[model samples]
Target: MSLQVPRNGKVCVIGSGVAGLTFSYLLNQLRPDVHIDIYEKQERSGGWLNSHHREVNGSKVMLERGPRTLRGKSDGSIVMIDIMRRLGQLSQVQYVGKKSQANRQFLLNGQGRLVEVPKNWTQFAKFVMDPISGGLVRGMAHDLLHCKRLDRKTYEDESVGQLLARRFGSTEIGDRIISGIYHGIYAGDMNEMSSLHTGRRFVEDEMKYGSFVRGMFSGLGAKPSEILSGELMEYNRSIGGQTQHNWTEFARRVKQSAMLGFAGGLEQYPLALRAYLEKQQQVRLRLGQAVASVLPGTGQNVVVNGVHYDHVRSTLNPSAMAAIFPEIQGLQHGDFKSVSVYIMNVYVPGTNLIRDAIAGFGYLVPQRSSQGDGLLGVIFDSVVERNYLNWQTQLPRHQDDCTKMTLMVGGHYLNKGLHLDLHKCLGHVSNHLGVDLAAYNPVTQNLLARDGIPVFDVGFDKKAARVVEECTRLYAGHVTLGGVGFARGPGVPDVVMHELAAVLHA
Candidate 1:
């Protein structure tokens, strides 16, 4: 039934980010009897999902300071739909269809020109001729012809750069393609990022099939059930049959779409979660209340800020966790690094600023082209959802003439100690888009020291494993990791999957 059901067990969830809130939401659903207390250091929920709403003249404009969209193809998107359907916020859901022009993603070439990433072999053949592809075609040939499997016994883990370099016979492919993707997503370095955590599938594929090319061919006939975890498959099944939610129908709606977002913005997702959790008598969201301490309590219970709980579910990063609970031996001063990103949300009304008015998702600044401006990427926020009317309102997302986008710059991974202010950064993006952004005044531009994007260095999975092993040895069963810090990736789906799995294990 509802989340208001009473329960005897008590649980504490730290950090009211996506992971903490989603964990609490799932907790009430699976075990409604357990009373939950969510602790957030910030004054609101939705961790980095901040949407700045502004009404200029007649049209409403939304600018995102953090994460903005969810890919429809990810299992996390389905999890979001399940939560949204329950929150009565499905009406706020928006879609970017697969065939939409906004789906075209670009990577900056060495000459600082935008080149559309090849979608097919015909395009790839043409694309590789350009120097920006970094001998991608030649690399693919090398992998197909000369690649050899790694020794499982010795190759426990490596950097994503190492993996790509090993297979492609050079680091060029990783530097050009994979680096940009990771930068855009994690604000991290491909050379330092863990292959065990990110490229494990490729590692396994190589070991099994000799190369990624052969691996891809071998997996051509795999079904959804085979690709997705049993837990996710079961969750989808459980929600699909729920006539009220009609998740099956919802999935059908977005399955063909490229990405999904909220009507106002992504902030709606976390706001909805907090609103729903607030209605439940069994849940308490302690926003603006930081957890000062976490220690082992009597029996199998853990104490959070002096309050005893049956279990402690932490969404805090490893460093934050180490600070709070020093007893966790292996968690001390993690090898992982944090990155500072400069996010500038630009909203220019009645003007299509893109070069030649090109309609696409936006271009990413890869490793080779990352310097000078520190522009990691640009999200064509308005362009991506073009032609898609507002949810039920049947109006364009913004004024027909308005264009919205976010510029990322000065990430520590690439430009450490680089503090390129919004003023200095405008010209770089302007040169790329062929617009004088310096002349147009915009809203919301600043540097955010976000802890959400954790830079997982090589051997991170091993370190994480050792931390878990130490926790199990030290705390017995009092503490559990669940959030961006512990998840395989910081994506919404990864967070939800890891947290829910921890709940089941706990």
Candidate 2:
């Protein structure tokens, strides 16, 4: 929630990345009189939303080097849409239809073969016969018919794997689908990630209604924004003072789409934020400036790089936070491990690389088989995105319709030593795409982001709370942490929600 500035407030925001920029923008809105400064070590404002444009074989293609799209029906997404519409860029909103071919999802089984996670009758028939679906039907049946609902009061936190085993009454579902889904989303082990932090409703469904399928009919559903704080809701209302579009209703409509993004790319959000925030008279963006420390000031203020401010909000990860404040390292009670990701975006002009042209969103490799070959997932970029960043002035759709995919490699599997075997990784990708690496020549860009995605391990919520408590004490209540690997989730929407809460709380 951006606040109405009470007076001449000064706040220093660390990291001009998504979280930082978001925090500044919200705070500026709520407290217009407050002078805000954003410090980013990198020259760019957006954190992992790099959209690179290139002309490949006479066709213009936009390659998203990082996160390309946002999930629909999220609290953060609604807020994001409101911000986008207010930015006067609502015309740029692009939606992939709910009935789009991109709605189909795949999972790589233990045999390392991609199979459609059945949706329609034909695919369901094939899935029933596939080895990957060996005991899935029985497991689902057990969940719907045999499993007994746990008392809501007696329920405790458990890994998603444990939930599947207990609720579904089989391990095959976990092995075949759960593992692949979590690996794609978290780049972490399904057996290790917490069910509550990842999907509380999923766990609660089995606890309260005996089964997930049954819970859909239980009439206890909640909207994504229903859980948001009243402060945030008020902030939304404040922002919506005179706008015609009801963003909540708009977001509900958007939730019907398979996915959504800007016509240019996800980077459009942050870059646009940078440009607009720069225009604000009360805002100052300190790009390319590294913060040495954020120490408590003499009286009623925080000092960031020798400048005293009423507040200093940091948007860096845990390790980055610990770097500037070593005292925070003592608060760690459990692992907050993060994984590095090696992203390879490929643009194969005029030639469809996927065998049989099996068009779907993408497939994810399960954690059980991801160690030696850590290809977390592949994005069918072209299936979801049909236009380049400058599509307004770019080549025709057919000319840009070549294979566009992104290979995300080296997460939990290779996070140990942080190694990058580009050729080896590309070989795995090309193999999945039904091509020989030696013969395939595609325009590609490789990017390695160290400790990019955080693993939401079991008990991560408790451990993160303790860390937050300790950090609050260390900073003498002058600093706050609002970034990935904290209490909030690691998704783009989560980051936005976290900062909105921070702004309201402060």
Candidate 3:
């Protein structure tokens, strides 16, 4: 897949999110002679990564609209850490402590109360015996020992729910555990999403060894980042001389159980990337300009916005990309699925909440828990970053003592619409936390209207592969597709590795 791009070759990147910017940044560094143009339809270049800070009294209140932190175990974390070091912004990166990673998270039990997730064998046994988690734990155990072999000649796609039911004795495990975690990550429906695409490693493991447990045991010693990239070690080695060693140090840090974020916020990474690109003579950033369509140019060039380019990498969603290049197969409607989620930022009395709340990262609500309006989860921003709320307070009486949280809602409803009201979300949190916000005197609230999270449904493999092949053929090897929407895996690191591969292979 390696191609010798000509000197001074022109490459147009559509979208300036982490994926597009990372592609441009790495490409500029690798082939300094290449001309790059990054076009973003929105005025801001960071895509959905929005962070806001306000000064109350003398203290600072921070709110993250999207992607609060990057998991240390992910390849995306390693990539971002590497980029931070290269950009001279590593010092600005802050990591969450062991408590955030190692401590037990909560799940809303059938009794409408938060319950600590079991950690050790004793806790596991108790959790399994409890009525709330008994069925799920027993079902998962049954599958681990007696699941049937999934023999297939071609890539067979199935939903997380179907796979669990087929392999395990019951689909309760899927409806409870898988759905709870994935809903927060993808905002996807368990019955509709493709297990092959979303949980490929576990699925592939089961396919290879006839049991997912066996596959997990086989790779238990490997670093999570290696597993996340599906083994991109050789590709990393091909890019830079010290890539492997740098990644090794990152893996060590991950083992310490750290979830990383920018001191300012995730938005800083993209802002830094933009600033670096502006200094490059061959780089051009087109903000607030949308690409109407992409067409083929004469010979080997690709055409967009009436200009010819040697290569074009699209980080747009499947539907958006299909609208621009209608000729590409399998990018049409129904091939790709996305769900919109409403995010509410709430501020509660910090000192009391921190001392009284669950004190870990946050809590996830399983579908079986039967919560109102099907809320996905709530993130304890202040708890995750303990220093986020430490500052002087503006009010003479009220010091800087408020816990900040981001409430995520409406992931279960794919077709049905969800009516999101601030008071409603607050009411849910108030009841769940057993705290009355009215007593806090002044409660601050910010809302992120909507953001899309992609879903890979059954039969998505053939269609996704077809789309990639068609794009490559139509552009004559000049167009490479990548992003959270286009990649095999989810999250930031998967997309980073995807574009990294394109530039390296190119």
Candidate 4:
């Protein structure tokens, strides 16, 4: 099917997140003649993937206030790698050589003491075997691993909490662990989340192995020795340049023809895509142009924009586009709430908080242990090898002198709403590290949209599916939606790229 191009056919893309930028890039690559117009609500693009740097004591320290880490696994990760390679920044990609040793995940006991997460099976057994936590774990394990196979069709829509309580005992341990996982990722409640959507792999693995314990032992160890021996070859062939690409270098490489600014922050990603499209004679970008309504046009699609974009020919899959933009009234607009997080970047004079650079990726604060108002996570800026630091050489500075540390605190509903209480959480963290926050110069505090992430509810999949179907039905052979809403994880770029590739091939 040939894409009909007028004397100057224009392609309008909504949103400037990775998905939108990626789709624009892909479309430009495939049909350069087709004018591409990317409209971003934000003043800039890059979405949540953003970084900042500051000079401290004559040394530069880079702080990743948002999305400090990237994953090496997953198909989406491969797409990000490919984009970097194409942009000629593949060599800049670097991975954490050594995993962080901060396994200090704590669960708040009834008394509110912070206890360390179990280190080994022995510790796990002992912890779960306890009278209080054990019964819960056992019950959960039984429900999760020993329960009869669920009807796959009906299971996809089941609530996580309902599934867990029904399959596993609804004990405190199960509840706490489930809550912790949800809080760590979605910052959401399990009862509102779909078990199949969130825990599909876990459920599959359990059902396949007949028990979580057996699954862990057998599945983890079941890798063939021959395949394990070829790990180096496998790693070398993988995208993102040998899986050694660190977050900073990775971001730098992925950002092509993109401007960076602390003012607009993440908004730059989408704005850049808009700017790029505008630069193209064929492409046009319309800002503040909320798509109020959409309807089927003869052998094409019509989009209602502000005065500037009253009516434009949409060269996209009519059906798919229609699914997303169903009805001219904008009834399909999903409700969303915004969240605000304040990132505190501190520069200590001469302390090397991270002895090993590779081992300082970061740590996550499980929700169950957040204690109402607590910091979400802390990324080791010095440890993540980037241009900000000369990690290859030995540091001449002594530990007692000074060092830089970036403390990321507050974002979830509980933490953001109670920002005043974060001072205590920050104090606790500072005291734990024996570092004085007052001593170091505060680099900067960037407040990001707390509602930055979409909340996927129990029926989100169904709604999203309907949107896709409507878009396909309306636009027919034009238009596509790709982003975190369609996919999840730190490797969102990868997913966008993969989806773009698939659409192109199709």
Candidates in order have lDDT scores of: 0.75, 0.73, 0.73, 0.49
lDDT top scorer: 1
Provide the lowest-lDDT 10-residue window in model 4: 256-265
- Which segments of candidate 2 are over 4 A away from where they belong? 1-6, 55-60, 120-126, 141-156, 168-170, 216-233, 242-249, 329-334, 355-357, 368-371, 387-399, 416-420, 474-476
Candidate 3 backbone collisions, by pair: 57-394, 76-493, 350-401, 350-402, 350-403
Query: Which lDDT value does model 2 have at 290?
Result: 88
Candidate number that wins on TM-score, 1 or 4: 1
* Candidate 1 Cα misplacement greater than 4 A, ranges: 1-7, 57-59, 216-229, 236-249, 355-357, 387-399, 504-506
Candidate order by decreasing lDDT? 1, 2, 3, 4
Residue 122, candidate 2: Cα error in Å is: 6.6
TM-score of each: 0.91, 0.87, 0.89, 0.71
How many steric clashes does model 2 contain?
Answer: 8
| Tens digit per residue, CA lDDT, model 2, 1-506 | 23222369888888887888888888877678889989888888798778888876665678898888877666677677668877887767766655667777887766767788865578779887877777777887888886577777866778888888877787777876778888777877778788878868787787777788688656535434434446446657765443334544565665665566887789888887888899999999988998887776687787788888887787887756655665576434325677778888877776666654457788888755453666788888877665322212333233344678888887766755556677777787666666774475777888887778777777777777777787677666777777876636778988988888888765
* Candidate 4 lDDT tens digits, 168-218: 655355455556556546655567666666766657755565444454566
- Model 2 scores worst on lDDT over the 10 consecutive residues at 387-396
Compared with the true structure, model 4 gives a TM-score of 0.71
Give the true-structure RMSD of model 4.
Answer: 7.6
Model 1 scores a C-alpha lDDT of 0.75
User: Which portions of model 4 show Cα errors greater than 4 Å?
Assistant: 1-9, 55-59, 98-146, 206-211, 224-298, 304-342, 353-360, 385-420, 431-436, 439-444, 474-477, 488-494
Indicate the worst ten consecutive residues by lDDT in candidate 3.
389-398
